[model samples]
Target: MAKQYDVLIRLLMLGDSGVGKTSMLCKFTEEGFNSTHIPTIGIDFKMKTLMVDDKKIRIQIWDTAGQERYDTITKQYFRRAQGIMLVYDITSEISFRHISKWLDMIDEGAGSVARILVANKSDASALRIISKEEGQTFAREKNLAFVEGSAFSGDNLDEAFEGLVKIVMDRNKKDIDEQLQSIKLYGSRENSTIDAEVKPGGCCS
Candidate 1:
């Protein structure tokens, strides 16, 4: 039987508690959001399949517990992630401030994973403290893709995940191309060496 998906990507959600990481994941995967926020435990994952440019992609989004007590457990998931959403709540300045700390976590645990800075709760414009410019500026400074949207309204959620997927896929393609090129070069070099060592005749000659 054929595989269910052409590509499999593991994405991780990292943010402080109450930043709407779980809501964002649920909204993207389940197409619904709960107004009542229930804190995630150590870790939980949701799977969603999407098609990008004719390739079926299976995304496994892991939501990590934001509370400090679960920090150790959350760190273990980072290494395996192909992409990460560093989420923050627009209404909460503290949450926005914590994004840098989350970046530190990514640097330490995630290495070079594709990342996007997600500012959630855009529907709460009245309560929002972090301006769009600030989010964009920070994302630029950190070299991360940025998207500000609402899990409640479902704005830009699809773009956020799809953009990250595109980044990962492009990186994967580039890496594969580089490996193939290297293999071809090595083969050429080995063939040249063999031809040079072999005299104009048989091995016995």
Candidate 2:
């Protein structure tokens, strides 16, 4: 732990095909998106290390195939994820409508994980079908981090990932506190038991 990063964050990407999940991921890890079209087959991931709040962190980002056929395979990765990005095309109503299905998979696979709603293809305003207000409303209802991004033009990709890590870090801290409290409680019980059998001189008199 001392030699490497202080924490590890596993972020999973999910959404319909052609929503640019792969492209968005590439933008974050590579600082550029591939212009050539190539759909993700089953699953893939990228690892990047960063220094946040003076702590070293390694973010493992996983991208899953959006096709229904690969749902079973992709769901397996949700088990240990700390953050989840639900991406959708800003220009496709069908893709936006199907966000619920992807969200359901997360619930079943990575329940209670930190969630963010990404309105991708913000650069394509002419082809846009989903309004920014509509997306923001949905995110507000669900209490999720909301951001508009464009992988091709390089927009808020960094903000989206940064927001996710902050959420995960807060949760991780809470979990650690709970565990420490439990250990203290158990130790106190053991000490009480020992005291009950001994006299006042710190001996079994």
Candidate 3:
């Protein structure tokens, strides 16, 4: 049979309420955003397929509610996540400051998933409370890819999703290589056992 390539990557978007987590996902998947506050109730999921490095990657993105009360509810999705987009509002300093707490929750729940730091609402440059340099520095400190994007104007939104998919694909490739090596080792051991089990005439006793 011809080799089939199907890679599934689960990604979670997290941030305080009104940080555009849902809007970002909507803009990325549907190419549009809503102006009203349609608060996510529990968890909303969307899937998109992309070609990364010539491989088909199915991205399962989970848009999580930002309300603190839903923290426990959202934690369930983090366990199986491959990548996480930590989002913050550029115009909300309080939201920006709470990033560490959110990261802590992810660490405790999701282990060591690949992460990207997203600064949303780039269209509101006039009311920006967080600087790009500051967000970049924080992302670097946390070892995350940084992206300042606007879901409203649709600027740099594609790059954000592309960047995340690239990271997830790279990690998946490494994991697959390791698994192949392990399978090879196991096969070799099985072959050795079969060789020893054969008699001089290749007949079993």
Which candidate tops TM-score? 1
What tens digits encode model 1's per-residue C-alpha lDDT throughout 19-90?
A: 888888878877777777678777777778899888667777778879999999888878878888899999
Q: Per-residue lDDT of 1-205 in model 2, one digit per residue for the tens? A: 1335455678888898888988888878777667665777777777677877776667888787788898987877788688899999999998899988888778787889899999999999999899999999988988888999998987998889888888888878877455446555542121122213222211000
**Clashing pairs for predicted structure model 2, backbone only:** none
Per-model TM against the reference: 0.84, 0.82, 0.83
User: Candidate 3 local accuracy as lDDT?
Assistant: 0.79
The lowest-lDDT stretch of 10 consecutive residues in candidate 3 is 196-205
| Per-residue C-alpha lDDT of model 3 across residues 1-205, encoded as one tens digit per residue | 3322345577888999889887888888877678877688767777677877776556778788789999988888788788999999999999999999999999999888888899999999999999999999999998999999998888998899889888876777887456446654553121121123222211000
lDDT (0 to 1) per candidate = 0.80, 0.78, 0.79
For residue 104, what is the lDDT in candidate 3?
98
Candidate 2: residue 30 Cα off by (Å): 1.0
Task: Order the numbered candidates by lDDT, best leading.
Answer: 1, 3, 2
* Model 1's TM-score against the true structure: 0.84
Q: Candidate 2 — which residues are off by over 4 angstroms?
A: 174-205
List runs of model 1 lying over 4 Å from the truth: 174-205
RMSD per candidate (Å) reads: 15.2, 14.9, 14.1
Q: At residue 33, what lDDT does model 3 achieve?
A: 73
- Clash number for candidate 3: 0
